[model samples]
Target chain A: MKLTKLLATGAVALGLATGAWAQDKTKVGFVYVGPVGDGGWTYEHDKGRQAVEKEFGDKVETVFVESVPEGPDAERVMTQMALDGADLIFTTSFGYMDPTINVAKKFPDVKFEHATGYKTAPNVSVYSARFYEGRAVQGHIAGKMTESNIVGYIGSYPIPEVVRGINSAFIHARKANPDVQFKIVWAYTWFDPAKEADAAKVLIEQGADVILQHTDSTAPQAAAQDAGNVITFGQASDMSEYKPKPRVSSIIDNWAPYYIARTQAVMDGTWESTSTWDGIREGMVEIGEITDAVPADVKEEAVALMNSIANGEYHPFTGPLKKQDGSDWLAEGETADDGTLAGMNFYVEGLEGEIPQ
Target chain B: MDLSAINPVLLVASLMVAATPILLAGIGELVVEKSGVLNLGVEGMMITGAICGFAVTVETGSPALGFVAAAVGGALLSLLFAVLTQVALANQVASGLALTLFGLGLSALMGQGYVGIKPPSTPKLDIPVLSDLPVVGRILFGHDLVLYLGIALVAAVWATLKYTRAGLILRAVGENHDAAHALGYKVIRIRTLAILFGGACAGLGGAYISLVRVPQWTEGMTAGVGWIALALVVFASWKPWRVLLGAYLFGGVTVVQLNLQAAGVAIPVEYLAMSPYLVTILVLVILSADKSRAPASLGRSFHAAH
Candidate 1:
């Protein structure tokens, strides 16, 4: 009887405290798949969270749990955050798609946002940056710079996101230099520095003078630096510390503006379930500075390509493409629809190796 | 498949560097187990060491001091495990798992500022004539000091375990801690010291990864390597030389599989990705036919009054 009385009082006190706080400020929570210090994907996401804090100073309270694993644990974390009076939650990473939706169902009034995922619920929204647009420019640079005609790519996973990047990069590279060949080594992970470095070394040893990676980490940049003449592009962030030599340029994911807009929408009661895919024009995916290592003409061409893509003058996957088996994909002047790009699995023409189920 | 593109000398050199970290951790755990304690906190100690080494190296611009600090950091973290299991008579398994969790969290906290900061590079030992001996020289002499130290430690461990009086006492303690206690040997003291040594070794292994291998600090950079080292100790049948051999075998498979992928081998990429673990399991299965034994009193908490 005493334990029950204490529990009842404790529950009442907690509810009253949270209810009072909720009236004044909205509580927002973020779940990151990697440490906020990862200097890549999670780091950029955390920066967006910081932007939210700066934008909504006294109107909102923000909290984040880092390095939360995907699957059941993610669902559990989301449930706990919702129970703790979080008005909105952002679960970053593709693996959190299902968990975000599941949690959204239980907390119908609470809003949920997921990054790099396709799933959505009545109370959940999905958002991803068009990283392939940036990959096209990197491919053009790699094609122009490769002396061996061999460019290496390090893939994190065989998911559509990575496959789209490969296809986009390959298409533009072949356009710039018909002799260019791509050798891809799949590390099957988002971030393992040793493995990433080893992949870079093996590519260098195999005569790939230009390297690209979808994996987060600057190990490949370091590897390219050690190999002297080899060139690399930073993935997901401006790993510009190795500039003027190895890391000549990079694709930076800019999520701050989107994060602020969504937070504002939630506060204004205008938030709705929607899937958004924004590119360079909206300032979601940014291309980092092209260092002097890139030739003047190649740099100019890359800049022009970026401007064209941003201004809706060019489509990376516009026709004249074939599947690896040499079957027609997009005819000349024909562009790939978002449906095919969203579920991209096959390699384009001239690319070898399976996607790995 | 373009096999000619793969350089034999570079592959051997790269594998050596790849195997050193695990080999160091495995040999250390072998000693800890030999002293009748199973410290499952190798992963935690390793990440702690990685961050400590990276931070110290970045701050002091000295890779050598960074390694020393890594050893100290690892040993200090393992001391927590020692206190819980040795002094408090806590459950070894539970305490060890807790230690790993604590270490990972603590290291991440410590590593928050050190991320993306490159550490001082450890220079390779240039041994004049030997380093210029064509392919052999490049494979043997063109490596940093840690690679050589790892091989030397393996040889030293084998010699000590096989020939020294201290090794006999350690073996005795592991076989029957109560009997060794009855014989007036300080069983707790010996085990504690062994645990600290094991921690230092694991730390060095982690430092090797951060300071030389990848040469930068990243969260969870050890990335299940500690677990691999633990499995390696068991796979080696608690023998130091076998641990070295196993590390090399696993490392060789990892390097070769990457090479195969780069060469565009017809095999599926998934199969190639899992080849290292698969080959390790295959070798372990083949070796287990000999019925290797573990130390009898391993993982048992020693209480003098009991």
Candidate 2:
């Protein structure tokens, strides 16, 4: 009888210990659209996740599911994380907007943070970096550097974010060199290296000396290196391995600061559903070091353009812009409102093609 | 549309590079299906080869040795599938599917440290005057050694399967494994050898993508090429030369669509993007109606005891 009582006491203690442990730790789950090693967008988001871990230590537990396709499938992953007792989750992809919303309704108590989506709920927060500002800088450099007067762009899906980037880059390129022409190819995938490489090479064969890509992956950089005398800018990550040559400069998405702050709020019970769009000024989008492949004067001009955007002294979609069909958009000295930029679907004048709607 | 910007010579040359990977993998799968064993693990095996070849190339700085390592890696993985289906008598379909999953997971694990590191490039075979002979030169002579090897492999496969003794025996076993076994032809042994050849060829195909095409390692870099290769084998009706033709058609359309988009042609981008798949299927489907069918014993597990 005494031995049986002892065993019963041990079982209760073990059960209580697990319950207390679960209550004490805040679990954060991350859903990534690409592998952590994609070396671009997903890789940068994962770095932010790592920063959260470093800040909170054992008080916070982190879990991540990578390469989650953006469809009904993403709903299953988000729901699974909620069922597993996650306190907050970050869905990092533009394609996961609907899935994030659907799962948010089912798990009303779990907090959801999605990247690059506009929808929000009582428990859902949306955040995105203002990447167009970086594109303005890249365009200035691309315009000044292209000896062939032809610049190539590889786009990953014709989303508003991508459309805005093309407009911003084209505007600056035209501003710098009136004779510059833009050649655009939509790759439709965010991270297929072979497809991205093919797009870059095709553009090169058509006489484009300067290449720009909004897709995630360093394939274009490698293609540019092989083509010799061609230049490309790093996208989403530093891609420092190809520095000083094909990769002359870069637009880096730095989410660590925002990730850390959000986690801290959750821990302190101060979290609220909000929309955050931070750019270079707020340190969410950073401009990587400009390598010496570019002339010193051109790098300085690019840096000046970047500073103007950060200081709010300039907006990428500034005055005198027109729609592709020649309809007036922003009049002289007028800037685009956040709502218009958020749902951007039209190409600016001289962008050379339909948005592929 | 600025039609003048599109270069026909460059377009054909790139399509050859784009087609080599699929050609290599398709010809390999054809041999496997011909041996009365169906392995759906081509994707997994190709990805495994991609990493193995990439890692070896990065370490040794020699693309040739890297390709050899890729072949060995692919064959070793296929050996697992052979043992499960041949010795233990597992369901061939289930075993093949499992092998694919295992290969994908294993490759992802092996490729951990190899991402972002560019491998040494495979040198192009510049054949002097022939390489400079305008359109003919660019399309026919200006490709890496492996691209030529892929063509040579298709020729060798065609010659051997159509005229050689080993080819006759292999076909007889695929047609009637029981009869071949009754005649003391060692049916299981022949099937195993075919599976190994398929794996090695698939490995070489995968290395072509990592070492020459994209020339860098990324997870799932082979993407859907292996599946395309598998479909090409069936689409070509298990014929070697047609597989080559199908690969070029698909690759050619792929390159041309991108070129069209770059040239700012007025075609819908989505339709252009899918035209390669459509054109290949339409051509091969029409041709298959005349005199083509799958091997009878394909995907059937054989047992001497039964």
Candidate 3:
């Protein structure tokens, strides 16, 4: 009899709690692919999440589940948040695309935003930043600084986003220094530090003085620092802690403005399914200060390149570009379309070796 | 493929550094499994040690003291396992899995402050002229004291297991705990000590990564390496020297595959990614197929009343 009474009281309290959540607070949920303390990719996404909280104050309630593996498990996290009265959910990782769509179908009223992904539904939105624009600036500096003419690239995965960075960097690198070469190593992980350090060491041993990574860790920067001469560019967040040498420059991914705007839309009932891909011009992709490690002229050129891309005066993918097989991709003075760049699988011309299938 | 770009001497040097953590963890697990206590919490213990070591190093500004604290922290956590499995006679597997979950959460909470903060480097073994020789210097002397300690730990474990009376007694207990108990050997006390030792070694391995290898602290930075050490012990047929070799070979495959990819080698990326596990297992599988096998009383709980 006592157990039955306790159960009835517990049910009433739970109902009232959830009832309070629905009546006033706009609950926003975030699912991260790596730990929020990763100091790189997930770190920036978490900063965006925090911005949402700061923007709305008591009007919004924010919750997040970090280190979520990108598979069927992601669907479970999204489903739980939706059932718990999450008005909007942001699944932050390319791998979460399908899982986001699957969970959105079940909770049609729950708006879902998936980052760095392509799939979308009436209830699901897809968003990404043009990080290749920053990569172009990195390549320009790398080509100018590398005494060995060999720049190493540590790629997280062979997805379009990563492959696109490789191509964009290589294209500008070749233009900067005709003899420049790129050595690409795919790590197959987004967040393993030991593996990333090993990959950086391997590239350094093979004579790459300039290292640009798409992986989310400071291990590569540490490895480069230990090597004493190598220079690296930070990914996702400004890893300025290693500044003045190893981390000469960085690509800072700013998602706060977008996250704030989207959450505001949910509160105002103006939320709609959308595909948003913003970059330098939109302040989604930013270039961190080019440090003294880069030559003055090279740094100046990099800044100029960044400003041109930001102001619509130049496109990083401006043509006379060719595919890896020597076939023409873009005609002279022609720029790449968003569709081709989004699904980029083949490397641009003059890039050695094949993109691993 | 530009094979010329692949420098073999430096590869040998980096592979050893890469293999050190697993080597330490594998040798420790070998001793634990030899005592018939299967603690599957090596992963949990390792990450805990990583944070403990990192946090201590950052606070005290001494990597050496940090390593000691890590070992103590890991052993302290493992003492919980020792109590549950030895004193209470609880299920070893379930307790170990629970310990891992507990350790991961515990370490994350502990390491909240240490994230992105680089630990003070472990002081190098400056062997004067020996460290100046070109290829030989790099492969031999281009490392800190902890790395040499990892290799030395393997050798000491091998000598102790083969030559010491304590090893024989530990083996006897593992083979038949009931008979050993009748012979006046305290099975519970022996396992608790062995569990502590296993926990300490796992801690040292975790510290090697956090202080020397990656040399930075991040939540979950151990990254499934403890589980790799667990498999390595079984693959080495519970032998110490073979654990050292197996770790190097495993570590070598990973470093080499990355080099191959960077050199633009034409091998499929998927195959190269899986090659480390395949090569390690292929060689160790052949070695483990002989008469040498697991202990007679492995994973079976021992209670005097039973």
lDDT of 2 at B301: 89
Best by DockQ: 3
For model 3, residues A1-357, the per-residue Cα lDDT tens digits are 686699999987996697577658999999998888888999999999999989889898998998898999999999988888899999999999889988988998999999999999999899999999999999999998999999999998889999999999998999899999999999999999899999999999999999999999888998898888999999999998889889999999999999999999988899888999999999999999889988899999999999999999999899899898989999999999999989999999888887778
Residues B244-270, candidate 2, lDDT per residue (tens digit)? 999999989989999999999999898
lDDT of 1 by residue, A1-357 (tens): 686699999998987787678667988899998777776788788899999999899998898998788789999999988988888899988889999988899999999999988887889999999999999999999999999999999998889999999999998999999999998899987777788888999999899999999987777877777778999987888886777678899999988898888889888999998999999999999999999989999999999999999999999999888999989999999999999999999999978677888
- Whole-model Cα lDDT of every candidate shown, in order: 0.89, 0.90, 0.90
Ranking by lDDT: 2, 3, 1
**TM-score for chain A, prediction 2:** 0.94
TM-scores of the candidates are 0.95, 0.95, 0.95
Q: Assess the local accuracy of residue A163 in candidate 1 as a C-alpha lDDT between 0 and 100.
A: 97
lDDT of 1 by residue, B1-306 (tens): 778889988899898988988998898899999898998999999989888888988999999999999999999999999999999888899888988899889999999887766677898989999999999899988899888888898898888878999888999999999999999999989999999999999999999988888877888778789999999888878888888888998888888988888888888999999999888868876786798789999999888986
Q: Give the DockQ (C-alpha) for candidate 1.
A: 0.62
Query: What local lDDT score does residue A353 receive in model 2, on the 0 to 100 scale?
Result: 73
Q: Which stretches of candidate 2 lie over 4 Å from their true place?
A: A1-23
Model 2, span A118-226: residue lDDT tens: 9999999999999999999999999999999999999998899999899999999999999999999999888888889999999999999999999888889889998
Clashing pairs in 2: none
RMSD to truth, every model: 3.0, 4.6, 2.8
Clashing pairs in 1: none
Candidate 1 error regions (>4 Å): A1-24
